[model samples]
Target: MPQWSEYTDGERIKILRGMETRQSDLAEMTGLSLQTIQQAEQGKRLTLRTLIRIADALGVDTSVVLGQQAPRRSMQRDDRAMVRDLSRTVHDTAAGLLDITDPPALEELREASKACWDTYWRGSYMEAGALARPLLEQAAARLHDQPADEQAEAWGLLADAYRLAAYVANLIGSRDLAYAAIGHAQHAAEQAADDVRRALVMSGRSWVYLRDTRLADALTLAERAATDIEPKFSTATMEQLVAYGSHVNFAAVVASRMEDKERAADYLSQSHATGARMGQEYRAHGTVFGPVSATTQAVGINVALGETGKALSLIGDIKPVHERVLSGAARNRYAMDKALAQADAKLWDASLETLEGALLAAPQWARHQVLPSVIVSRVATGSTTRLRRVVELIGTASSTGGFPPATPRNAL
Candidate 1:
């Protein structure tokens, strides 16, 4: 079989639509004309907006339709395995079927949960999934064995473990497992009776919705979560500020995706204010928020809204020290946004260089992101050699038949 990247954009759309979804059905679903759908499938006059609408209607990322990434059913073998193990762990633990004879102590489970989150933020998603299975089993076992007084902490740990599982599943394109894991996380959070944890679980669920192209649902839930944890700043603890800040920033993200510039700006202002009050980066409940995060995230928001000049300006405002403070995954994400802005502005060489550097810095994480491929596809005129190199880095080289070998997690 030919690699996905070998197909024309139109062919990809037709294949993704499958026999069950007629062109008229897709047209209605996307609120586009049937002629538009037919033209898009024939690789004629398919605008970016139309492509995004089609992809959303099809329940896949634009990268999948662009042939830069495979659809969920065609995910790589290792990705499938990781999702499989995570699915089993999520379901088995929720059903009380795990036979964990010797669960780790509560403190040990807490530390393990932190380690799993650390691995995930480091962009070692496969490793994170591997770590999450045992963490979930151990946390569930501890929850079952702990007495009433200690049960809350165990439940909290289990919620954290499930959050990690959800994150991994979402990134790996296992949407069903992502929803299941986050549902279990929310249940555990509720059992713990921790308002902040519940709010964070809502934030996680909103993220799943965002990736699933349920924009309105994502925006609603993010706004609600932010409101639930809104801090007074005068007396609020660091945890409250971080949680609230993360939610507002995520709201900005969802709002931007929806092209609601006014609402996006409003949420961004709140995020910036929350970050300013916090004074520095704070990580809690598996989320990060701070001045650096707020600013870096804004670059992408602006880029999404077609404000390339604003995005470039924001990128310029980022200090070297601030950039250094971001995690591997966060840093790569920022790089992709910067490269995208540069591409939009026709700074082809700079865009390619930025993309190349990011891909080398964290190939594992870069592969999971759609932005790298999006950036490459937008650069229509560049040094063929350099463009080819960027293509190879993103694993879309037709010569390779598919993506390159997976980068070892330890390399990052």
Candidate 2:
């Protein structure tokens, strides 16, 4: 696992600042000397109760910081993976120690968490989410500390891990785990300050709601994230900051699913405008977004706006070869978008061809392709018998809220 030394300077600085602010505020609230506060902020000395006191003053949930190693396209061989893993473990341990109350347990958690982080970073998002969750829980239960600050931080880290776990589990069709993971994120959000970190917990919740097809709740949470609660954050600032674009795009997708085309278009326009002002390149950064969210937002809004043509054109412009590596997921997603775009244009043959190719490439996630497939089938076959088969295929594969219930209004 990675050690504390493995962390970037920026990460160290962020942790330091959080600790310092927490300390000084505690001192002022308790009428302690500024020198004492300054000394603690500088890591000169701190007592168990002092840490606990500051934790209370700062409203820190626990010592665990919600951090992730940088995303990589691919991990190295076993030897290299082992080295990176060590670094991650060490780094998480140091970060955990900043707020841990029990010295020995904190050390153990640090070591364990570092390994967890490394393992998580070592695989694809699908694999990482699955592997990291149980370990996160194991570490959480094993670590015991006294200081309130340490207690809060440790709990917070556990919550962060669960949130990640839940998101990935939900994506992969694990409902029970997703629910539990959401519980963890919610738990973390409660003790978090009005920071990007806190907002992310909310963001995680939004994803859960989306996966469940609970559009109203998801929209509510997403809109909350888009708000300016974090005063220093700009609308365009990506860093850990929440962007209105994500909310807009998410809302757009929900609207599109509901077949509320006008509403979807409105949301799409708003998202597009937000994305524009946010800058495509900047939005792609971990600051505003990463691959999934960034591309998802762009693709979703455009598709909803009935401008899939334009959206596919933009996707093509991106050249899809990220760092000379053609990510299978990205490629599949691109094809899916193209198929949908063709479907929108009423080019059934082209849509069918593209979708068939996508299904062959990655069959599991082709659930989203079901609707277009149904439409294409309907267009190609006038017989209601074949159309029903096609719809059944779609219903079985779709993650949508049970075939949209087949309302009379939509039937028309």
Best by TM-score: 1
lDDT of 1 by residue, 274-315 (tens): 889989998887887788999999999999999999999998
Model-by-model lDDT, in order? 0.84, 0.49
Model 1 regions more than 4 Å off: 1-76, 396-412
> In model 2, what is the error at residue 404, expressed in angstroms?
21
lDDT digits (tens) for residues 145-217 of candidate 2: 4455556655555555655565555544445556766675566556544255466666667767766777678
lDDT of candidate 1?
0.84
Using lDDT as the measure, which candidate wins? 1
- Return the TM-score for each candidate structure: 0.80, 0.52
Off by over 4 Å in 2: 1-126, 142-147, 151-153, 228-237, 241-245, 258-296, 305-318, 321-331, 363-412
